[model samples]
Target: MFTTKIIAVILCCLLVSSNGLQPSTCSNQGDGNYGCFDIASQGSCTEVSNQPASRDIRWPHSGIDSNIDWAIKCGDIIAYKIQWFSGGWSGWYVPGVNDMDTKVNNGNGLRRMWSYFYDHTHSYIICKTNDSNKLRGCQ
Candidate 1:
């Protein structure tokens, strides 16, 4: 059993390396910067319906079992998070309210990110990681 576990770990490590799956750490992250789930920094967005920079409104995926290879991990919540990788790992966020409001924060929330960034729909621009950093759309 121990041997099998060791082999599994080795294989996993090998796969991670061969598959470009980076092994990042928050150590390099500067001080005072929020960690993966910095719920405190989630201040507010001047406007929720902010326009999208990346024209591809169908990219920068979310949820598990998705096109994980091409997608970069952005922010994460409890059950899941948005994918927005950057070589290894640029870092992560805790994600804030869907919309800056005391009432329309749920499904009513705008499918945009902080400011006018572009986060697909899962969260918002706080987690944009599309190809070539396309922020204009199918232009």
Candidate 2:
């Protein structure tokens, strides 16, 4: 009888502990910051400069799975990030120039796309005249 009681207690303890343990999640608080459920946080975004700048884009994954699709112009660059329940968050991966257009799983946690400017200047100007001819490929 004592052995059966001890086994029941152990099983109860395991159930309680399992209920308390849950998977971590990252949430985009909308201020360019990804807030984590268990850990501290992922990161944030910064302004864009002509010299070189990057911004961190975040998405939350509670249950549903999704993907993020983006496009870039000029000479900007981009990268991706993902996190799993087994391992920690993955490092930033810079995709090749020809592989710019792609989609990533949203459940992998908040993803980031970085845009860079190789020019030595910290500012840029886009000239758009009223004429259709002036509508260049600046868009």
Q: Scored by CA lDDT, what does every candidate get?
A: 0.35, 0.36
Quote the positional error of residue 124 for candidate 2 in Å. 14
Candidate 1: 10-residue stretch with minimal lDDT: 60-69
- Could you tell me every candidate's TM-score relative to the true structure? 0.17, 0.21
Model 1 residue 27 CA deviation (Å) reads 22
The residue-by-residue lDDT of candidate 2 on 99-118, one tens digit each, is: 23144544543222222122
lDDT of 1 by residue, 36-78 (tens): 5535534323212223344342332222222321233232221
In model 2, what are the clashing residue pairs, if there are any?
A: none
As a TM-score, model 2 comes out at 0.21
* Residue-level error in angstroms, candidate 2, position 100: 8.8
CA displacement after TM-score superposition, residue 94 of candidate 2 (Å): 6.7
Q: For model 1, what is the error of residue 45's alpha carbon versus the real structure, in angstroms, after optimal superposition?
A: 24
